[model samples]
Target chain A: MKTEAFVFDAYGTLYDVQSVSKITCEKFPRHGELITQVWRLKQLEYTWLRSLMNSYRSFWDITEESLIYTLDAVGVESDAATRAQIMDKYLHLDPHPDCHSALDALAGVPLAILSNGNQGILDTLVENTGLDRKLEATISVDKVGIFKPHAAAYELVEERLNVKPENVVFVSSNAFDACAAKNFGFRVAWIERVTRKAMNREVDEAEHVGPSTMFKLLRMQMEDLGMEPDYRLTSLNELVALR
Target chain B: MKTEAFVFDAYGTLYDVQSVSKITCEKFPRHGELITQVWRLKQLEYTWLRSLMNSYRSFWDITEESLIYTLDAVGVESDAATRAQIMDKYLHLDPHPDCHSALDALAGVPLAILSNGNQGILDTLVENTGLDRKLEATISVDKVGIFKPHAAAYELVEERLNVKPENVVFVSSNAFDACAAKNFGFRVAWIERVTRKAMNREVDEAEHVGPSTMFKLLRMQMEDLGMEPDYRLTSLNELVALR
Candidate 1:
């Protein structure tokens, strides 16, 4: 496969979204993990819901809104200070362990992040993680006023990068993103961070699974939406082999 | 409000979707509640997702697919016969206790169902529940090839019923549906079946909430999507007063 550019989904593919749990737990005590799980899920849902409604809000706004909803849903009273403190974590999300190495291995390729994140957040996040040095561009759905899984959102990659869909390897840990990218004609590599065996075992063994495990069960697995990714990888480190 | 028509959302509004839990419990033992919750969530998600992806599958297909995914996620093995037996429950979903009385109260008003369900399933469900006598039309997204929250889906009501959006009082128990219908210019009545106080109490009192309660926590509340329903009522019977 002659992959011309590697376009990654930032939040889950290259950045560790679960890293927010550290801060959430610190602030909310017992409710941290649940807030983290619900916050992320609601964040994604808002994007889809807004997209379907043709109501375009910036990803930054959506993130804050979803956070507020999550706090209320989990019975935590959130003030301006608390909300601001938690929201700041998005700008400093820890890069996945393999993120730097994988980018370095494909150093010569035109690497960029095509994320549901707003450009300001994406830029800050990449720079904070020292990934700005390797990444050529940090694309945001803000440019198009819609979120991922929408065809126009995927089209932003080709529009900005000057690459055809077939030549770009769109990588995402989100099953819906990978499916949509593939459906939009990109050569997709779905980073399967959660394995099927692990998922089944978690469900079988745990009488009451925690928020993180439940998140994996609901969101991490591949969707049955007819579009399958060209490659199913366990980690971003595996992307080097494809390069 | 000179109400020209009353268009109801079928699932969770007129029909009690949770009633499927009875059969799911019978079929999957302890996993039934989880299956029911996950199944409903996934089913709504698939609609939004497929709509955004521009890949329109009939609601029936999406329902079955979500059920299969739910069974797998919950660590239950499902075969074709098992799937069929469980799916059959959709055709005969129990009407909410208030459904008939509410419809009956608005005697002379033109009544219909505007649903994401496909025509075949909607017809059978309405007929099986004896709602067909009161309903002049069972409007499915099948006619428009898209699901709710999309303006196009709501536009079908005006197209078929010859009723303008402002004159039609769109009633739904689904918050998202109510918001979308209101956003599309209808006089939307959101049936608040799960009260905010009840939801908060459920979260505060329970150590680990059940699937049904979790569904209420996650889905039953009004969205922060800017489009609020014109009226918020605790029961369908309250809708009669608005008429």
Candidate 2:
């Protein structure tokens, strides 16, 4: 009930997949869509499979497996050479529109990114996202050798931040993770990008999926907990109200 | 695998959560959103919970329970009158765009709808979507007292169709059901909506889910000894191609 610090799921929560996909996607439109969707699907699958298989790989390594597996699943038949570009992009995604400033707006509240990736990958992400200096710390599952909802990954944040699960607001873009964390007794927040792609030109009227962005997700999380932000903003200026 | 028939999971597979929400979502748009989301979250939860409870309710009854539970979960302040309207609209949801024609096209395939719903509600849906008459038969959990992905529900279809599991082509919009059926050894066809829904300008894009007609999901059950669709359709019309 006492959320002193906030913990976030990195991949889909803090960064956007579509944005990450820009490298490959911007080059080949047809391949771009499949690349992002399949890569993401495989990344998640590998994370779970590694846990299920009792083998743990760093997020960077898993990114490789994800690319390979995604290509195989979709029958894209990519060679390792072409796949390196896709895997490499994972380290350099743009921070979501409101990311840094939004965190900046959180006043001095400690913020952390917990992931099922490796420390090296997390470091790269931090550097790319520019959160290395802004946020409190970064946490990854490599320490526990397990993915989240496993209690281990969640515990990693607890151990690192010294914040109890109830005191840490957990935000994740994955639905099952929210369900898992909530069930595990964390005051959880759902980032709401449940499915793979944004449904893009597919459904301009999808009603549930598309370009709502994470602002609403963050808003819903705040509303669910009855914690009104210092102020709501379309830009970093929203963070100003906190100051 | 020889498929004598195809089975579909209702709510998310053959239909969608927002599709039904369209009728009942106006009351407390905010609460309505939670209600719809949790209503869905609970339907699956109820099925799983009841499965674990070893006490079962028809999915229809469970849906009602979920809706009310969702209202409570999100703190919806609605009176009895509003609740009644939402409940009625649930069974009256029209099929997504091509549902009627899709059913008409699948005539020879001997399809059946297997839902957690009660027979009465199933009958109402059949009458409402008109997918009722076109379907060869409708099977509700009320008969067997079990929900889907449960081995028994799958068995009901096999028993009714007088075919082996390998001989059934299972179609569902619920991705999990499709995965479940595929894992359970049925020929699974995913009905991916390839259509798009234009935004209703009156609705803010933030609230706009976008796209009434969306890309219907389709994963053709393959020749792989493992996954096969046997048939795929955007509208049921593709069923004619089965011949």
Each candidate: RMSD: 1.2, 9.4
Which candidate achieves the best TM-score against the true structure?
1
lDDT of 2 by residue, A1-243 (tens): 455887777776677656756766654444555446545644664455345334566777777765654444334446666777766777887777767766777757888888776888888888876789877888877888877646667778778998888777777655546655665567766654322123222222333542232112211222221222222223333333322
The residue-by-residue lDDT of candidate 2 on B1-243, one tens digit each, is 455776777765566556656645688664444346545644664565454334566666677766665555344466778878888876776566656666666677788888777889888877787676668888876777766655677778777767788877777755445655776778777664432121112122323222221111111211112233444555545645542
- List lDDT for all candidates, in order: 0.89, 0.59
Question: iRMS for model 1?
Answer: 1.5
Candidate 1 runs further than 4 Å off: none
TM-score of chain A in every predicted structure: 0.98, 0.77
lDDT of 1 at A47: 93
Stretches off by above 4 angstroms in model 2 are A1-7, A12-87, A94-112, A116-120, A127-180, A187-243, B1-5, B11-87, B95-111, B116-164, B173-176, B192-209, B213-228, B234-243
Candidate maximizing lDDT: 1
Docking class of 1: medium
Query: Which residue window of length 10 is worst by lDDT in model 2 chain A?
Result: A214-223
lDDT string, candidate 1, B1-243, tens digits: 699999999999999999999999999887787788889988999999999999999999999988988887777888899899899999999999999999999979999999999999999999998998998888988988999989999999999999999999999999889988988899999999987777777777878755666678678977777788999999999988878
The CAPRI category of model 2 is incorrect
Model 2, residue A156: distance off in Å is 5.8
